[model samples]
Target chain A: MVANHELQRAEEWSGLRGFTNLLYKENRAWWGTRRWWINALLWTGMLGGLAAMVVFMLPTIAQATDDPAVAKAGGPIPFGLEMGRTVFFELGAMALAIGVIILCQDLIVDEKQTGLTEWLLAKPVTRRAYVLAKLVASALAVMILLVALPSLACYLLLSARVGSFFPFLPFLGGVGIMIVHTLFYLTLTLMLGTLFNSRPPILGIALGVLLGGNLLAGFLKPLLSVTPLLLGKVASLTAGSQPLPPELLLYPVIASVLWSVIFIVVAVVRFEKTEF
Target chain B: MNQTHDHVIRTDGLSKSFGDVQVLKSVNLAVPAHSIFGFLGPNGAGKTTLMKILLGLVRPTGGSGTIFGRDVVRESVAIRERIGYLPQQPRFVEYMTARENLTFAANFFFSGPQPKIRERCEEMLELVGLRDKADRPIKNFSGGEKQRLGIALAQVNYPDLLILDEPASALDPLGRQEVLEVMERLRKHTTVFYSTHILDDVQRVSDRVAILNRGRLLTSGPIEQILNGRDGVVYTLIVKEAPQGFSERLAGLSWVTHVSAPETAGASVWQIGVSDEAAAETALLRFVLEDQNVTVTEFSRKKYELEEIFMELVKGESDGRQS
Candidate 1:
């Protein structure tokens, strides 16, 4: 005859064992699939690209920093400051173009293409939550890419160029500008990626918007030349030797913001309406 | 998310259409709690559409329903919170391990404790028989294995309602059997509402069935009830060859009601609707033994396949959709 106490203890032990077994099962999936390695490599390459670009630019920066002042007389800004500013502005513009385009490309496009779109959507999580998770994951991945590569290259280049890279505040400011431009581009690209399912079309549209905005700002600059107050419309772009008019600069920024918001809305709507 | 009502699912005057072609008509259906409910329809039938509407993934042109007692549209979140959906083709993050994928899914559903989430993932993996492969990346997984992984992910939150849309259709015979076995095991914890045109599967697992065609449910009830209907019983008699007036003689018998000559190659089959099982058996034996030319090939009760039953009910529904 078995004692009641012994029977109860045996039951409890089995229950605990059952739970332990369950935990082991959930952890098992990590070993069964090979797709995660590719994703890791993709992120690594993405960040590596930015770092490589910055490293490649080191010689041009060193040359520019070494050259004497180009102005004849009564210069408003120092020669070194002017050259640094030129490099910074060019870097900023290019970063904006690349970042927005890259960021706009969504993780969902592959999901949609691979027919996994229907499967994931059928799960318990809402579309809003799904979209939010992808955004957070992609954003974090991009942040790692942006900070690891560009900032590292800049820090190393400055250390090599100057004895101590003193006055790090201005350098930090330039990086901060890059960060904002990257965020704007990322947000813009994410929207475009979600709005369209194809990669080529999304890339095409993203590049078109980036270049078209700058070109349109240039063509419209003369229209506003009579009224310099419209300089705001061209604040973020450069045409020929002139920087964007502050008034006209607002147009591109607002346009980018609007596009980002609208594309996200489309993604959410499309996701909702889709059968999956 | 919502209070459990008498009916777990309710739809009234539901209809769906793609342009001029209507897939569903004014159909009404209700699934009871704690029972296996099967939705049976052919490939182009509106079963998937109906399930999507219930999930709020697809917008129906007309009609409405309450899933898990929550409005399928306005209260989709509440409904979704209590339901686990496994699609026909489940897609997971290819870069994440099965465990990592489950963890990612758990973040959205479980808000309690981190350890509990891990524990829940473990439980789900075990349920789907993927405990050994929990760390595997999805890209390396087989089609059947991925589907099992999909089910594990779906059960992360321990949902009360498990909605599977043709979860086994993609699998080969062994895979299909494996999936159905898992589904059988899952019934203890959740109410399984699955849609599939595979009659054998439905007949094996479902407590009740809803057969739909042309976007409208032709019949919805217990599988036995729908199958039994008002017909008595069909007796299928296969002879070595058809003798002249064989059909006429079977029809003339007092015990036989409705006689049908079904399509078959090697044998001449005569289906006779019998009034009483014992009497039909006696008479069938007597008639076959009395006839000298009769070489009995096969004789048994002709049970209706679910496909045949579904076709019989929804055969004319599409003609209405054509207009």
Candidate 2:
């Protein structure tokens, strides 16, 4: 019996035993259904396909229209750079923020409300492992299908419109910025889901923070230093004629990462203290 | 940590309350290892709350508990690692099939090869008789099927202690019998600690039982001892053609506390309450045989059913509170 107990303990302590199973379950829920592919195609069309249309039509409108202001406004900036800027900063970031909130707002809330959290936590898995697995799995899915793939497709369409001189390094930095921004919302939504049992409160608070923070940062300049809105400037810094210095991006990146960590820590603590 | 410890679960002064509502009040329990211990209670009696406390799914407001000599609050993860729990309403991911659910549960404890995990899943499926419907989504399952799968998932790890909260509370008679059979088969491998309001099921399978009501433990002991009446002993006698004053004469004796003939038109069955079984056996039988006109047909000790004992204890406690 002692030997058997020791053997069981050894087996339980193995690499990612509980976390991997949870991850697999999460991935199966997302990828094993048709919802993932449909969402991916919908996002690609909305973000990438729209950027392509704008890029392809801008030159024609510049030549076809008699208005010199329209031609000049569309002329000075390279078409590829404008497309990258519009897709990365505006459409891509906004869609990802909203998409992540929609995807993650119910991740913990549904489980808790349906009594699945109690069932899962009754197993040998730790609370931290369970929360982390959901966060990690959802983050990976959103990053790959929602953010990275669409951003790449937008860049390719932009390149096809103009010459192949796409500013690759700066564009990569912008995508990284968008990713960090999306992580803020994802982690925040997950944290709120952990803190509350209902979906409306989590959704309202997370989305309110996303949209309200942007509007608040515009009026209050000091808020820009700490809020995730600084990530919005990544496209302007990368593509526009007057680009901000590269060092200016460090503060917001660090701040976003710090917020993500804080949200995750708070979530783990709240989840650990929760009773069923 | 002590393997030689006899009790698989031990709790002392285990109390819990949600704000002003006290659910469990100083519940001390010691469930012996390898025994099918029944936790009997009415609705809202804190049976599920106590099970959650033992499983460490809920914290105790005031008290401590230990499973296998491990602190419930501090070493709960270690405690849970060896125990299997089925909640009152067992909920699974409805999208997953029975096999997928069991495999997912097994992965938490066993970190072996894929084949080994699959083998374990197959074993649990067969154990619960879900092998035929292993691939069907659990959302399509019946209530009994879901409960059977819940049992299989609970025991997937081959735990030393299985805590099931009302394992057969929502099943039909046949379904309840199948679940009880599975639990009976599991007795050789693990100790089964289950809670239910069904006294008949407890009487049939459980070796020991604890009765809880209104957040307090009214009584707890072995089945035989509890059924034998904790206060005193009583023998039942079936006599025919008794004289008019026989029962009155027996009741007048010092050893015979009370006598009642339960049936009027039948074999004149009389339940004789006794203060001492040895004295009653030595004298009562001789006295009964000495009567010339009386024909004694059946005579034996009367055992109370669990339902009767539970009702008596609960009502006694209620009357005590009222007084």
Candidate 3:
């Protein structure tokens, strides 16, 4: 009886043991290849180079014009805040969202189509572990290369032009918002990959939701309360004069986190039911 | 788990279907421990499907199976821990080298001292004859090399049961021989359950065999027992000399069910199928000796090739289905 109990215990816990190995494999795939490095360099260069160009040209354009609004826009505080806002909203958020989608689009679909999922699942790993490892590794890659690195570069370049007046909290908050926004699409793309075995449908559905959500949020003002479009508004809130409203800041963060969790749960459930 | 049971794998009334199409129909199998079991079937014969069910890759629609006394579906991870599988078309990450792939597979089972894992990988690479090309990516491997690497990866953990689906189906004759040799070596440590369309490979390596066709099990047992025919009563009698009514007289015997006489190089060889061994031993020789016109040259039971038995069983099943 004791042996039987021990066997049962061992059997129950065995599936959870190999998750780290799966994570390691995923990490090697992302970091060891040249693809991740190239993408990272391109994204950082583009975002940093664009911010520098704006910082150098804004003052020149304001001095040449007789417009008071243009001159005010070139002021140090406004220029720094506006530059930070542009980096987060235009470059960071959109590029990270698209980057997450591209990185994870084939995470589960290619494995299933090639029968690698079947091979790996035949080991001591659980379905949950397999899905979680992919999510964790891909999320880390997006965070380091697309979100964290580019944000740092953009902040430095902006500070050089606007004279170090950027507050740490608002800039950090902006970066957090971009991460949350990216997670929404990353998890959604993973869920879609689990649901479908082909590249076209996964890409089509994820890209459609992303571009369509942005388009629809423009027309539907109420969606700002819940959708990721609220994330785009973070730049303005951080750039404003007053302290950040708790509800205004809390709503989109909470909504993005909730949607990410839901997408992850749906992906795990769908992957569990998938037949090789 | 019962340690006394000799069977490593057992299934009762196992069936699987995808939508309206049934892929396996009430398959009952018992694979003995530490024996090489050959699963033989033609194309679209549900061989791979049955293998998948056992490994828990695919679920069965009806019935149950057990490996090492654990339910297949409920305790799949436990079952998987003790078994290694080589899929029909084995796929690995093409970007990773053979050594890296093996290391990745080994990591799932062994969390070890780094040196121990590296040593095991090197051993497996040498065993599969891929030691020189261990660092080369799998995309650079030939088909035979890839198949060999698949075998090494499957057996890396030294599993209790090694299930290989078509291990050498895509290999050349020399490559097939090498894969079979590896399997034969592994037989001492594990029960090898491999499915293949190659009968000669099965005959050369398998101690037990099972035949499946059209999603149904036709026959299964020891290789010798199956090759000896179900009834164990078949004899080949060779006679030389001139006798006009020799075959007619032999066919008239009550114990003979089938008699075919084909003249080979002026010698008539008659394959006599008998129903009773006692009758054949007591009266068969005397009956043939009674005919003074024909001189008996050779008299022995006919041995069957695996191909012959497989064809007979498959054709018999097809005929039964049509009728």
Candidate 4:
């Protein structure tokens, strides 16, 4: 019923046509409803609550007990920093890698199965725009809910235990490192979503890369340099202000970023040639 | 735009194949502007495949097509910008409200003030008679309501061409009537090209129709021309009592090609196939009344139903293929 003259022409053409609209729809799915607050509570409770227990409850337990072995194990506040660094860098990274795989598993496959992809492509939307919008919006949501906010909370919890602020820049760098690592898995899952028709293969291959990749890296030493294998160790060391050679830190970060880009390119290319 | 044919949609020798199976043969069709063009075909008749090719949802294996003089393959995006599509089974985001779905579909074309967009969505809801259920989630809608929503979304862009695949195929009688009524009202604004197997619906609403059977275009033209019978004109006469020379009286004329008298319970009926309509209209009835013993109960030109023609065409094509 919209009058013909009242309509405004959309300026977007080939590659970027309908990109903003799709991005808005994807963003609304994350932030416009209860999804935002629910994810914030879930990730914060898991990551920040564990950090709080590490810095506060451990020393209290060591003081309350008279056993020497328990006392030695509890150690001091530096021990809490090490534990907090492990919580944020290692555990947080692994949890977020798994979280992104579970979160974005349906981003493409569900739409394909439900006939939404055919419906969407019938419009003026280009295949590139569709895949790019999904990649950008989902990455932002996953990083914000699973990485940024929870990492900030962990930072404050560790700083509070030390009776002063922790080094802000180093912690921020570690958060960036964790984001790159998580994006590697996020893009992998999204690419797998495009390649396969169902959720199992996407979940299987992405999760395998996260868990099995680490296990295999223990034997295949060269994989530590070329893959995202050493990213967690480098993030933990960097956040704890421990120094190492620059290549040890730089190589994994570069490798993870490169792999994420490759995954996105594959997703877009495969989706372009897709029929319906 | 200047065109070889003033058609909103034109396809030349369009064909599609999946593996070893050829679903669409060389189909040449032209749909005129601002008309309700009915695409009639039975199941597995390649109706949906051809629609998908025009929409760029499926790639054709051979030939080409154009919409508004733009190439269907090279300029598909630009062509799509001026058209709206509704699949046979319209699917929407189940959790989103009807209003949200309309707005989503509209945003693919128009991007301006949010209030203007909202106003357009509301107008489409009102047009489809879904104003009362605008805020309801699509998951709660019935089959008819979902179809109405599909129509609303397909019209949100005010497209110049609207392609609907089996719009009323799954609906009840009332729902089908409502869909046809909506199509009737939109004829002045846009060209509607819809595919269906329902002969009655096509006969009632379509000005132009194309019948497809077994991936081949059997016949296509204005509905009236198609109903006039392709072989020639035929006249019918019912006689109560007929002399033995009654058949010879009609067949003796040069214009009359064949005369067939079949038995009826109360009277005798004759089907007169004529080479010229004027000759039959003037002399055929008079020839029957000339006999004093014969009582002419009924005399008129035979009218063909769409169902009859569709059956004949399908049967002929099927028989032709078998032999």
lDDT of 2 by residue, B211-254 (tens): 99999998887888889886568988898867899989899889
TM-score of chain A, all candidates = 0.57, 0.88, 0.88, 0.94
- Candidate 2 structure quality by residue, lDDT tens digits, A109-198: 998988888888887777888898999989999988888888888778766766775667777777888889899999999999988989
Of the pair 2 and 4, which is ahead by DockQ?
Answer: 4
> What's the DockQ of model 1?
0.18
What's the TM for chain B in candidate 3?
0.87
For candidate 4, report its TM-score: 0.93
Best by TM-score: 4
Candidate 3: residue pairs that collide: none
Ten-residue stretch with the least lDDT total in model 2 chain A? A1-10
For model 4, residues B163-232, the per-residue Cα lDDT tens digits are: 9999999999999988898888888889999999999999999999999988888999999878877756
Instruction: Report the C-alpha lDDT of model 3 over A198-255, residue by residue, as the tens digit.
Output: 8898888888877888789789876766777767567545533336677677787888
lDDT (10s digit) by residue, model 3, range B1-323: 35426788898999999999999999999999999999999988999999998998889999999988889999998888889999988888777899999988877777665567778888888888999999987887888888889988998887899999999999998889889999988888899999999999999999999999988999999998888786577788888854887778888999898788877997888888888878998899889988788788898888899999999998899999999
lDDT of each: 0.65, 0.83, 0.83, 0.87
Better of 1 and 2 by DockQ: 2
> Candidate 3: global Cα-lDDT?
0.83
Predictions' DockQ, in order: 0.18, 0.47, 0.42, 0.63
lDDT of 4 at A19: 96
Worst 10 residues of 3 chain B by lDDT: B1-10
Q: Which DockQ value does candidate 3 get?
A: 0.42
- Poorest lDDT segment (10 consecutive residues) of candidate 1 chain B: B106-115
